[model samples]
Target chain A: MTTDGSWRHTAPERGDAVTISVDGEPVRACTGETVAAAMLAAGAAFERDRSGAPRAPLCNMGTCFECAATVDGRLLTRTCLIPAREGMVIKTPGRL
Target chain B: MFDLAIIGAGPAGMSAALTAADHGLTVVVIDEQQRAGGQIFRQPPETFAGSVLHPTAGYGWATELIRRFEADPRLTTEFGWSAIGVLHDDAEPDGLCVAINHPEHGTRMIGARRLLIATGAYDLPVAFPGWTLPGVMTAGGVQTLVKAQKIAPVGDVVLAGAHPLLLLVADLLIRDGVPVREVAFAQSIPTPVDMLRALGAVPGHLRMLTETGAILARLVRKRVRVSSRTIVTAARGTEHVSRIELARVDRRWKVTGAPREVAASHLVLGYGFSASTELARQIGCELVFDSPRGGWVVAHDERLQTSVPGVFVAGEPTGVAGADQSRAEGTLAGLGIAASLGRAVPAAAFAEAERGIHASTRFSAVVQSIFEPVRGALGDLATRETTVCRCELVTRGELDDFLESSPFVSNVNAVKLSCRTGMGPCQGRYCENSVGAILASAREQTIGLGGRFSAHLPIKPVPVGDLRDLDAVTEQPASDGSDTGRSAS
Candidate 1:
């Protein structure tokens, strides 16, 4: 199992995985995985702080930008379209 | 120009331009792209070098109209010119002189009696973490890159997200030899009862189903798995995309404990789009909000007249519609604008336009219902950290606080004033609906006059540089609109 205690190393054919932190929790994700997909694997659904409404990945890709979170101190990073890195720290904007 | 100056040469704008010009009105159609067809009916670069569209139905008709319009001596089609601004002329009533950045020729100002804007819409991409990574792209952008550019998005791609357009895109990808690992269809399929109800919308429903079915068939041929009721929870990988986690949702759409992950190299995401209309607002068109139709839209009558006289609209800019509807409405709106300008539209033409518009609207309503932005599916509402507008860097809490403090409670304009949410480069295409939905939910009231949201103008963002020097643009470019319509009809 990887960090954040969600994803585990599967098999050799599954390909190489990478590690990143979501809202301060460390998680390991696969290579080429979008930040949103990795977060979902790590059980991180609510990517942003809720402003009196629940916020999840709306467009799931780029058009919505709803899944934007702080990555390595940069705000408004789209997790769905962004690929994961080995040591990137993601901040959950509007985290409860 | 005698009357209206349209900014685009695509279906929406061309429809209006041809219609307006036929009414003994001088019209100038300006576009940034080398030719018409926008992105929807985009053809190969070589084909557009001089080839035009055909006049037959089945998509070929668009080429035909272009050919006929090019032949119209009264009309001036400025291909490859960008509209800089709708310069507000103080002297003219409902008059706006447009500054254009003509491609080869310098800038020029064209005065108009009125403007018929059909700026059209763009994809609305919701930014997720890591979305800026290289492999991710909007479904439309991906399709354009592949179909128009002949470039593959990636080797093994995961085509995910909702919207009927995505299905078509996935099919296109497979056909293009792009390896699609799996399709994570976000919007759940209609329930059996819902499907049956949708059946009443036979033509519309059939259209959507057929498109989806085509994608499915293509995927099946390529042996790609199609997963429904599944939401991509997270994406993982190294320098590129590698794996995606899928969560199975219950009947209530609650993600179950069971989580599954798949591997892929690239991710294509596009939920859909709202009416992109920022230019219309700059010209002072009235707006109405209808949640079912996405965010704000321009106010136009059955004749497609805006609050400003002589201006008209058609196609997705009015709201999202399929290609056939857009073409139909485009044709009708052209006729309507012509009639409004005193060019008598034959009774048959009016009827035909009405029928096309009606059918498109019906389908649009169904699309709205199917893609409804449900509340709880988002996330915790109390957090102040989540971003609502990625481009503006406006946080969710900031807008909420502004809404609570401002007098324009629950109105997006007021909120925009307080937080600059909708004032970003992409305008409000991405976050308007979420904001509208939030406002409606917060006030516990329906949007607009009758459970609808307010529609605003210029539904999209006009380029700043395009407006820098408007006086140098050319007044005329294409001596005549030509119809060499050779791209796929």
Candidate 2:
């Protein structure tokens, strides 16, 4: 996704970057980007509900838990609240 | 224990912290976000170097206050923490105790002589067909993503609903190069006379007037279709938003035509906002229901103190007036706290703060009158097939069936029990009000009866592992008698 270049932000110069794994695939994002933003940027889907239907973030704020995913073996981790970190493993409903 | 402890580091909490510190009061504030500015002055990640080109809604004053609040040594802010439980019993006698938890840090009990719950508001969610799709979001939520993260959807975007945030966010999206197709409003276009009247009532805030005019002028020049009496009938898509449906409404907001479909990858809805009053209600501070003025807000006295003495409330928790009102109330609350602490208050500063409150009130009234949602607007939006409770996956049809079979189902809490509507991780923040509206239509009970559920301990979804260490915390038993108004939604 980052290779597509300027798909999201037109500004060519991004700040320092971090690498994290989303749905078992390595994704590069801005250093301080949230897991949800990184996932959305990488065109990845988040957790599935009890019905197994994919849920996207309705409220990017932490209050809405729609974007909850498993990060580093911690289940129910809100993607919007936690910042992206190096080598963090994120598990989502849809495979990328 | 500090002299003052505040929840939410938004405009109100940050302002209160600054005023308290200036008056020689020790202050500490906690916010769920990682920064001091709440939604209005949402600051990007400190590490992100990108800059936003435009400022909206008190950007200047809020920016200055947030900077001072962060740099002031006397004021301390604990970010990424939420108050889980509140205890104000005989144990501390000094003040109330707030139990907080973090995803990384386990749990800690903070005690303060005086407490302020300035927890802000969230986008009011109204369910409709295809609303659960991935591309649909609250307008403010998208604003945060665009304003803070500098990310925008690459495909077609549509902004719909009855809120000023829609206009502002639509303008922001266009500036960010997001292809926004249309700006739809459920309310009729505010006539020139209406705008003039509202503006005339609050003539001093010329900056706000000019800024709004400039945004509107730019939007008009861009040829972005801004239509009134339009409502989002449905979003048509499977997993992500592929298209959206728009319909025309009459003065009473009744659907008068078939929905017109348009291809869209993003849908931003801003129907209204509900105050995050979980902690306020949990502590038994009196709450009243005024739909436009932040539903189920804390009932405070002239000094901004909640029903519980030594516990003060300001900002959106008291009502959903924007940042301006919040700062005024925050300052007044700080002054009240300093006075209680036996500090000499500056008479001139106190008068100016009061004047600010009155001016904000005037502006708030105008904004409310313009952006208020008509009852008929939402009455016909969600269908029986729509998903009302996003957390529990309860559809309107399923809820209606439960209500039909179950005897004496009344109030939002009753609906929650009937089908586990509000039992999930969200704890009814998304579905409570929508379900309450359904109940009101069904004649079950009033829309809001002390929120979707009673204010319970551990208001947030604390990781199960963290609760194991809760055995050592003290418990305070407080009565709900403090709440004077509790019936209406």
Candidate 3:
């Protein structure tokens, strides 16, 4: 999996690094980074179709809702609109 | 209760709030975004280490406006609050209520003596085969990811669209070290004569021209392929987009050349913008059709007050004329609101604001003329198999079939009901405009009739549990001094 430092052009200078789990897999993220951003940075699909097809984040704005995923048991939460926190559990589409 | 309640914290709302507050008027600016800057000047998170300011020149003005807006004591800024519905009573004086929903606070109501709806606009909906693919998105959407979130999508990206914003997004992607393979514009590059005419139309706006020139120069230096009069006919892929097909089109957007395929991991498409007129329409504001102004816009007077008195509209809600125009209109509306409330505003100040508005509107007209999508362009790209409404899985064929079979179904709302085209989580924000266009063309009727869809309460999606709790939230009594005993019921 791609780390935040792999595809990033500039070094992130935010607060302490945090770990957020996606489908029980730990991913590294910074404090201010959004859940969608963290997943994209880590090269993980933020969504999946009913047939288990991987879906990337489109329209990072909350309007599209293409990046919606279950966060901490809440369904349809927009990952792009919410900031990532330590130990947050995210279930992508089709995972449930 | 606020003396003036402004929706949206973009250039227009912020300017209006700042101006109104400077006059000692109690004001509240409600915005859906977490920060004060709306889409154009959206700021990064406070903990974000990257520069909060936009890299583009002249945007520094936005930073100053945001700072002043937050520091002003008279202005109460409510971020992460979406204005769901508006209630107005003709029987009472200044009887206007704005229903706002906050993630943590549930639903709450705020009363205002005067209201300014500056909710702004979103990307125009353009449907095509494979548009629902994970990698396909609007140019503005991708720009937000890079500018506000500082996150770039991995792999090769292509910017395909009709507006000047495509160039801007491409420039940002290149600056952020994203692999932008090409920048494709649906309209042909302006001829020297056209450029000269545009410049002549907006005589003093040399900075606008210089900025465009600089972006083009950088793209040239980076060897980014720039094509014009080419449109993405289809985005081809399985779960995610892997490639796109481009076809040349004429001024009327009719296909004129053979289609060619290009490898791409991400496809960004923008066909201008559509005004977010739901709030204004909810309050029964008069709307008029003008393509140059980005479809239907709230009809307002020189003072920026709508036909409904004490109700004003600024920013993209009035028209998609960019931030400068929004700010100018906002200032005029603020002054008008203050004057209505018996506050002393100098006539000279009003005149100065009017002059600025006139200049910016003129410049906007010129830009709109050049960038407005060609009529029928979207319809031409959308095939029967193309997904028109992603939320409902409604395809172009289904809509066409519905229109063909149901002779009584003539408007957009009926289409929405018939096939659930817009009854999804997005609430028709993404597909209504495109569906309106297609239905209009198929029925041989003007697009305006199909474009008029009434906005219901809870403009954004709210859970059923939260909506049920709305009744429990105590409603604040009307404090505008002329209450007709409305209790937010």
Model 1 regions lying over 4 Å from their true place: A1-96, B47-60, B66-74, B101-107, B197-211, B235-243, B250-259, B375-387, B395-409, B417-420, B438-489
DockQ of model 3 vs. true complex? 0.41
Residue-wise lDDT of candidate 1 within B326-435, one digit each (tens)? 66766777777677666777998789778977876676676678875443343222136546675566766776677677644766666666677766534666666556
TM-score, each model? 0.70, 0.92, 0.92
Task: After the best TM-score superposition of candidate 2, give how far the Cα of residue B58 lies from its true spot, in angstroms.
Answer: 5.1
DockQ for model 1 equals 0.03
On the 0 to 100 scale, the lDDT of residue B178 in model 3 is 78
TM-score value, chain A, candidate 2: 0.81
Tell me how candidate 1 scores on lDDT.
0.59
Better of 1 and 3 by TM-score: 3
Sorted on DockQ, highest at the top, how do the candidates line up? Answer: 2, 3, 1
Clashes in model 2: which pairs? B448-B489
lDDT of 2 by residue, B1-489 (tens): 677888989888988988888887777788878777888778787776656434564456776787788787666567887788788646667677778777767676666788988898999888888888888899888888877777777788889998878878988887877777899988787889888878666665677767777877877888878889999989887677889999999986778999999888888999878888888878888888887785678899988989988889988888898888888899999998888788899788788888989988898888877776664358457788888888878898988788778657776787787788778888888877777777776764455542456677788777788777565454222122111121111
Worst 10 residues of 3 chain B by lDDT: B480-489
| Candidate 2 lDDT | 0.78
Model 3 off-target regions past 4 Å? Answer: A1-11, A48-56, A93-96, B89-93, B201-204, B472-489
Local distance difference test, per candidate?
0.59, 0.78, 0.78
Model 3: per-residue Cα lDDT over B1-489, one tens digit each: 578889989889999888897787878788877788788887777777655766465455788888988777556666777787877644356667778876546677777789999898888878888887777878877777778777776678888888988889998888878778888888878888777768766555666668888999999999899998888898888756888899888877788989999898789887888888878877888998777788889998888899888899999988899888888988988999999999999999899988978888778888898888765667757898887776767888999888999987888988988888887666887787778888888888878877666677777776666566444433432343223243221
For candidate 1, write residues A1-96 as lDDT tens digits.
232212221122222567888767778765545566556545564453333333445344233455667777655545654556688888875643
